[model samples]
Target: MSDRFELFLTCPKGLEGLLIEEAVGLGLEEAREHTSAVRGMADMETAYRLCLWSRLANRVLLVLKRFPMKDAEDLYHGVLDIEWAEHMVSDGSLAVEFSGHGSGIDNTHFGALKVKDAIVDKLRTPTGERPSIDKINPDLRIHLRLDRGEAILSLDLSGHSLHQRGYRLQQGAAPLKENLAAAILIRAGWPRIAAEGGALSDPMCGVGTFLVEGAMIAADMAPNLNRELWGFTTWLGHVPALWKKLHTEATERAAIGMNKPPLWIRGYEADPRLIQPARNNIERAGLSHWIKVYQGEVGTFEPRPDQNQKGLVICNPPYGERLGDEASLLYLYQNLGERLRQACMGWEAAVFTGAPDLGKRMGIRSHKQYSFWNGALPCKLLLIKVNPDQFVTGERRTPEQRQAEREQAAYDQAPAEPQERQYNKNGNPIKPAPAPVVEQARLSEGGQMFANRLQKNLKLLGKWAKREGVDCYRVYDADMPEYSMAIDLYHDWVHVQEYVAPKSIDPEKASARMFDALAAIPQALNIDKSRVVVKRRERQSGTKQYERQSAQGKFTEVSEGGVKLLVNLTDYLDTGLFLDHRPMRMRIQKEAAGKRFLNLYCYTATASVHAAKGGARSTTSVDLSKTYLDWARRNFSLNGFSDKNRLEQGDVMAWLEASRDEFDMIFIDPPTFSNSKRMEGIFDVQRDHVQLLDLAMARLAPGGVLYFSNNFRKFVLEDNLSERYAVEEISDKTIDPDFARNAKIHRAWKITAR
Candidate 1:
């Protein structure tokens, strides 16, 4: 080991084995594996290959010399003994990074300065020039690690950490380190699954890190193929011919491997905005053909029956800061466990989460848990075999779990009046026998028609959704007028909006019918009650509809026409997504690619999301409400379109009048009427139609098209407008089949300059 120059390949704490395997795969038989590093005998060619192919390595260091040291002078002489001329010209810029401490060199900066001074002094007279220090983008990188009294000097062959694979241009809220993600896939046994023609999926995939890494592992493609900047590219010791040979071999392997597939890889991100970024990352990695990321939640997760291959379900679910505060997240984990047990039978599961206690809520028993370091947060990869026996239908809860649930439920249902409940004198809580559970009443005759209509529409729209790649849509828009409710399906969650019934009907009878509708929805839909949200929609406008109904603030990510949207079924009356505009979103996406898109009265910025996904160069979404603007920001960031200049919180009219900038495409879908206190004045779409269109068209570039839509059933477009612009009523096309029964949904137009 001492005869040949030894190399040290440092990796993350949990990925030592992968690095060793990678080194061995590259013919480095002298590898000595450790906890966070692998020491091996590697010549220049082998070191170069390590940099190019090792997905688990952080840095590859080629040890030049080692010597005993006692003081600063000894360290200086020891550095000076090595020949620096062989690696770099005296005029080349150099940077030195020193680590560890001892021998009167406790300060890293002081040690690095001493090393630099010695190298410069030795080369100054011989080359008649001195190399300047360049911390950023150095031509030559020198490393010196001192322990006790021994100094080990090496050249940093990898200029920076190899985790920067150069393909991820945008990221999610929390992105996994590429190496750690790769290691997790390997540990989850993805390679074996791929070899056996099995599929891979991530129910909580954020930005498709695991999906992309898994695809790479399955394909046996080099991780660094997308990256162009190599640390050794600048080192003078680099052999071009040897590096070229390795590069050619990788290129050939990739060409052959990319087409080899029964590749069935998929990722599901509940955050609607992250869908586009995930696909973008997958495309960036050149695995667009193999990996597909969709907007979906873990609650609806199931193995595709068509795929028919047993595989792995892995995810990194959110781990909130405090255990007491993450009660809703507990439900997420619990639902995930239940889904895995029911739908993922015979498949393996890996849950990589920061909080092990929270992960316990998944309800599934883990066979093994491997500790990993995700930056500073210590994480665990809980591995389990998904089978019927591992998790049962009516699982019993432990005392601790029951206590945690009780505390969370108490917090969730704090009384508005603040009345104190009964407790024993010793402060010990008293318990009473639980009341017998009441059976839910079946749907009334009127409710039966509503339920039947719901089933009928679900059958109709579900087929259209599958064909159109639309995930969120309206199933019943008050199809049964007696029930007076609009049912919208967001992924697997059913949102039922009950229009306040007329006072002419008996109040008690109305209440009974509403409950019947609620009862019928979950039963007919065949989903749990927890997945349905019922809200009463009264006649209101402006801030009233936007007002909070309850304090249980939560948002679910939903997909519509290939775009992801954030919807809050429980927080407000509107679920953030306007399903009726689903058709318009499709239209906008068709024309948005490589254009400047402007969305006026942009509520939740769903149109902008569509435009950005369409490849719009830039987007501007203006709204008066900060709440909706904040929601829009999340959407923008999710779609990798977070330009502060693009999201504006001001009146659309004022923004339009003030902005002289022109756009290639403009979409205006204003409210019918808004008398909000925040605005300069009231907004009635019917009254403001002319002025709004004039202002919007002024900002529209030559030959640009403007899409105008409004939901005022009795109103009419001004005939005078035809003199200035060419307008066509596109209402028929805008209303999809699901909303066809309700003809007065909304009117749309394609207005253009005459």
Candidate 2:
């Protein structure tokens, strides 16, 4: 009898149809969509083929056994009943993963442990030895899923998530997940669209996921073609010869039909940081020749004269999640809409937005909306009909069109001048006259010379600070040409101000001399005695002085009265402590009076010290580097805190999941864009914020507050969160003097009662 195997392919929700299509394309006859999953019957050979080619699937699992499970014990026994000896070597490494449903197995880890125990116990009893568990890189991955009192045990054939397509050598701030990108493309009808030679464009394509996925679809290439490994390849039952044959067949098919270049697939992003990643991803996907990526703003994107084929534009623009400000996003969307209406005649456009409210500002009605998940947060893909010939070409006039026409007619009908209006004494109409331009005297050469002298003095002060081993120091004399400002940094404390210099010479000269004298004080006071490191601040162009008069330095010390730190106020406008975290601090102080606290990305440990002072029993801080953690410790010590605080130098997400201790209060403030060498993956505030929140919230005390904040100016709170927890924007209280009222450095929220 031919071997019959149950195969399941899991993907991000709403992409089941695409997965089914891919299965069919692979010659699987009975593919069907299930909730957030796809199930089908396939021979072992077909399973291998699907594993090698499917793009949108997160994992491909081969069912080994199925039985009615009454409880955890039933689950363990059901997993043991599988013919493990036939599919996995007794000595091979294995990892057990579980997804729980209604079997009273609410804890997935506990369920996974039960299954692991059963498998190991069964193997040891029969073979005298059992397979060891290897979480990092397992040889045989066992999946245990319980739903509706039934246990489904399967062998994970894809191993790691398929989204890690190996082609992305680099990434930008909040890159779209490869699988999610593929799903979006499939939902946009890429297979049919590509077959029709329809062009695709992503005007705001960051790192070119959409463009790469589009090119791959057009080229008929298997998503796993570039992947280095698959979970099935290591399975004991996998047939190497059959896998090789399937791979060869897929490659041959791709080569046979992918000879033509894709129909004008293009991507444009204004940020230079995204350019390199886009280039790298496109090249790694082998689509460099077929796809074109450029560094340009979405507002200015225009199709080339020769490549003006009307097609589809799919954009995943900044949804005010990572970018900031709803008002600013409206302007961007308005400009984008106008550009699309004017340039993309006969083309369709779709935008993926986490914020539906922002969708209203697009000034266009969506013909369709598809609900999908962008990394766990529910989002909508809005489809807009741009420049529809039936309406825009004047074949039909919708109500909106008629209203616009009427407004234009009314403007044209207004009288140019009223007959009863009298002329002014200057022979002009009585209406207000245009304001006259005012001219100011240009800077005299002496004044310019004085400014230059002041700058020289500041530079000298910087040099003096460095020479004196000052960890943080500012360069300024109150008498300089620019406003006199004091720059101070003892540790993480950065203070800047106009210096009131002691009067000894002409005001300007004395100011300049005061900076010179201040430069001498660092050495005289024996500051920066270690001479460990020194940095200089760069001045801004066109301005007579530094764009900022603040000090630019590092975290050198922390004190109770005030933390002393280095800052770069002039060169970069900020030294990092967005005062808005103050409210979060107050919240921590209130809750931390005697409980453990966990701070992720604990920069300067300002919050940690606050928690410690608030009488936190203890504190555990996790950050990517020891440098920042040490600074945090110093901040604690500076505040008369103690060594009782524990510090972990690693990725916060991974550390939190592995941590056994729960915290009463947790503060998570990740960088807007961080590419840490020590991290396993890139961290993006917009894309990973929700996942981070979930991770941190999981570790919170039953009544604890998970204070989460990000500096992404356009950050939009995930909407689906309302059902899970109470969220309120406490941004107003977090603001401080250092940050301007208009400058939205960060947004904070209190998450509790989940």
Candidate 3:
């Protein structure tokens, strides 16, 4: 017998059709769709199956009871009379969630509080034991929606939001939510395309969410197949036998379809930082074998043997909001269009962009442009088609032709050289007299003079580090014309480095002039002059052990100030220590009295010294480089720490697994990315953090506190982990005087066992 029940399935806007299809596939007859949500009716068993299988829905709400309401008082009374004892146990915990479109109850929190009061009052009146509220994860989730002066109350069948698909153990900056990715694919006609063996590709797949979603759609796999629990499992009216039957049927269906290979799904990204995340995400989605994620510049990407078959290329490239300037974005789009026209013949392309001006640079006439909302900003999805024969034989200039034309114009307008070149001997130009070597040496000496002056100014500021009660002080601003170099003086050491400026006129001259100016500072100050070192920043190549060792050993020297310091004067934007985090380091030092300390992602060990200074009994620091470990040991000795402290040069996860020692205080501050050869693999802050955090906590003593910090701006904590640990955001406290305004630079958390 079919048991009738009202069901609400919420989804992102423009994906209502996909939700309806998912509902119908779950045996829900006569499904109806809304703008950002869907409605339907199904038996209890079908609803359970929908929770397990529906990819597009965010939540599945089951209508438990309904009552008429005229005002707040009436609403409270109506809620109290719903026979709460029958559904919620007197000792069970509950949470009230509300969504209001119109009506007097505009504040969601106020409405939720009133609803909670009503439920508790009813339960207390009968059994004298009212349930408490648990905001993190509640056993019973009561949902209330108020629209047009009417209130609809329902039981949230999905305990947590359906977006917690359990497969995403890692995340990246501005990561598209899983459900949102599914909705986007559905809106892009993925289901229909999947049925016809249509391929999908994303040129700027940040972490391969779109590709994963497209693959899941092609494979007909249930979205919640990996999920551990659902809200329906804890509901009062849930039938265990019926739920099991529905899930088993879906599992059998998935097993039968698992043999089919996923559709051709490909993701390409220029940022090497995203490659690991894309690979991790694809593996997490169980589509690693079917999906191909490549690391390459999108402008230079060539089609593979299979991708040349002319499939669909769907791109969600940077819209200048999250990424940098609009002018550069336009150039990227222009190159993107050129690649499409050159390599992707007989293919259809779609670009989702929020910036319309940049979109115009693509040049290709879009066949269709659909408007959709990505969160709050309105975005346009443009569709363009390429005809294979027309693309090959079109009346367009060849790339070589364009280059030759530009070259000819440049040559015609070129200035003539001096007549000295015409006075040639033996068919060669006349050799000029060799300039005085002393004069050349004098010019180089003048460059060093300016660098010494800048170094002196930096040293003058270091004296105020302890006087100002500041952990660190910035002696130079990289943006300034005269002091374009950045000089950070930490409590233990000073970091001197050059900065990459925005483009300007006479760029080479400006750089050389800046170098000359920076070289004069150290000699001018005469304060521990040897400690002032120059570091040139550049892109890091593949990890090599000798290079790491050289970098570490290069800085091993004692300064005139009686401080043993390791100075890395070449390569890297900043010397290992970010002086702006000085305040947080001091705090760790102050709080480390008589405690065992574990520093995860310990770079250069500046913070470890502070902890040791505060009387830490034992300290264990783990990082990916033996070179960094050696430098860290030097820093500890500079602060008078002995060999009682240990430095393990290995992967943080591996060290965590092997170490049997427990730390009373643990600090985890991983780099955004470190490609080290000595390590088992690369370390990415956004991708491997959850596992790293779990491992760190395993070695933490009972009642120990872990201070975890990261520079990733858009980090989201896992929903399940919050239940086992108490987390408090301490980013505000971590800020120092030098970096007061840039909140995105770092975020710190205080984690403790519940």
Candidate 4:
């Protein structure tokens, strides 16, 4: 064993530079940065200190040996060459982790097993007292990395990862790892702010990761000081005295720091579920005195510190992954900016987001920016000094006004005398002045045009909707060529589907127009921006079309033709109830009295519910998705028509072929193209319509009516089907007024035995 050794400090991607600086400062000599690791020289004490104090490192590894390897035999012999007894006992448990792939070791698991076998063979006693494998709580954790054609074996000096920190046993769905959060704080200059005794706040803190990390940095506390277990805890070369000296120094420093007046640190989270968890985490960090958390939303967040105190307003709002999520996330970033401008005029702000384009929509100028990787996603840290100079005004200022602002901004940069404290009758300091009332966001010129068109459509359709007691209808259907979208109103909620622009048009221009439409929607419709759900409508084939857009299981109940049906606005591309099919459903209800009704490819069974309400004798609905079948059951339960209405989940074609029952009325609305794995073969409505019709017609009673409908715009009915059965095109009769503007929305027909 040597006093000095080479150490490799691994961290999340994009933190390598920061890690190198931190590691060098912590006594790591000759620290050099790699992609996600830093190679450095350190003594035993320096290695221990690095493990205890390094915030930006995920693991600290002490390289034992680096050997050339050509195959697995070389790997095994290389591991067997190391003195295993010097690290762990023969009967102790150990874990081996192998990474990279080369030199005939293509599989990491097999390489790890080979390494483990070599160690076990070397440490085996005469009575077969060999070291056992323990994945968790192992006495020794060995890491073997095959780089290029070389094997680098190291002893893990940091148990688990340094990011565990022991405080966050509970976290939100997407909690930032502790080391990453610390790296963000460092990049945002939180250390300098804390040294200056400035306050800190997070508007959207989830489980208070930022708050705890910031408090630790401010209080000069080691992040992993509270951790009870380490990879070296039970190793043969533990060196308790050396570790104790460094640990004692860290404890003493933390005690001295905590003796000072606690900094004003606060966290506000929109989710009430995470409020208590955040408080608990802060408590576990021994930072309860310095940090406080509250259940608050971004729209109403106001950090009430003493009047003159100003610090960083940091947050990491969600960056949606789907294309349609940008429309809603844009408003969120805008609201965050509004809060900063209105409430914290003199404060600095740092917004970490993956969506830099949405960050640009915040209506504030960031003076500096830093690039980071949150896991594998590249993100940006927008550093803003919130002041009048940084504000972005929608209205253009004159040359004189701009000159005056520049002079004022220069003056504002200088320090001013602290304001006199104001107190109330009860002896508490009076609240700070109310935040400035932010003006409603103004629409661009194109946005105003889109809004005007929407208002005109609403005015015309509003009366019709009110007259007919319609709560859901299409308000806009690509009326303007520039704004190619279909907007529908489900009660007060708006669902906007942007049609994919053709490649002939500039993608940038198309995106701009879509943003303009989204910005115009809330104001033009007089609704909250949060109530709108947007999705891109494109040509989807196979199973992609049936996939859920989101996982929010929330469903809203909407009314149609005096029946209640559930609509999930955010979860699926299609809201359960189709507004265009309102007239067809009504027609079914009108003619379903005393008839046995059947619906094929019944999505959510809206029509079956209508037939049940129409006094049908019995109704049967079949579809391939159990999700839809369950939803149909809920619809039946909602309308109190559970009995005598059967819901089936299977391939519609197979079910139709096996059915022997006759129905007085049948409705078939098949998808344009479906290749669901549950089915034996692909189904193209145009190619297989004849077979589907024949199978369904076999179950149709004499003198029965069968209605078929599809939305394939280019679909043409075969002339031979009319020869076999009497067929009439009832497409015009099935379309409602809302779909009159686009009569090609769907085609329908009625067939009867000849």
lDDT of each residue in 1-754, candidate 3, tens digit only:
2278989998777667767887898788768887788887888877888888888788999887666666788779879878887686888889899888445676889888888999998888444777989977787999998877778898999888887787676666666678877766766676777788777878777788888878877887788887766675666777999877877876776666567865677887654557887898788877887889875445555654464455678878777544343433555676677778777777777788788666667666677777776777777887777554233224356789678668756754555454323221112233344422321223256566565555654455544443444434565555346445666554334566565554664678767766665444443443354555665444333332115323342443322112233445444445555655666787787899878888887877777767766767667888777656766755653443432356777888788888788889999887667676557777776777788888888888998899988776677666666877898888899875455535566888899888
What is the C-alpha lDDT profile of model 2 across 1-754, one tens digit per residue?
2387888889887778778887888767678898779988999888887777778788989888789987777887787776677777777788998897667788888998999988887677454778899997898888978878888888899989888888887886667888888877777777787888888888888888888888887887888876667787677787888888888888987786568755788887755456777898888888888888876555457754343576778988666555434433655666576667667767778788888777766666778788887877788988777755423335357799789778756755655654343333223334333433323223444444544554565466544433333334333323434434444444433344443443553677745544443443333333332431222323322212212333444333322212232223333344434344655665676678767788898865777766766767678888876645554544543343323356678888788778777888888877776666778787777878888887887888888777788767767888878688888777776653323323365788878865
Which stretches of candidate 2 lie above 4 Å from their native place?
28-32, 101-104, 125-128, 305-308, 388-754
| 1-754: candidate 1 lDDT, tens digit per residue | 2335688888988788778987888857588997688988867677778888888998888898899999999999999987888888788888899988988878999999999999898778654789999887788888888866889898888887888787777887778889999899888888898888888988888899999989888887888876665566777777789989988998888888887963889897655567898899888899999998875556557755463678888888777631123544555677688778768878999999988997777667888889898987899999989875566444445789678779856754665321233222223333433433434556778678766877777777877876676667788876666678888888778998888889887888878878778877876666567889888899876557777777676878677665666789988888788888888998999888768889998988899888877767677889988778777766654443333326778988888889989899999988888888878888888788999999999999998999999877877898899999999999899988878988788999999999
Q: Which candidate is the best by TM-score?
A: 1
- Model 4 TM-score is 0.57
How should the candidates be ordered by lDDT, best one leading? 4, 1, 3, 2
Alpha carbon lDDT at 724, candidate 3: 77
The reply for model 3, stretches above 4 Å from the true place, is: 101-104, 125-127, 388-754
TM-score-superior candidate, 1 or 4? 1
**Better model by TM-score, 2 or 3?**
2
Cα deviation of 738, candidate 1, in Å: 18
- Candidate order, TM-score descending: 1, 4, 2, 3
The positional error of residue 355 in candidate 2, measured at the CA in angstroms, is 2.0
Q: Is candidate 2 or candidate 3 better by lDDT?
A: 3
In model 4, the worst 10-residue window by lDDT is 420-429
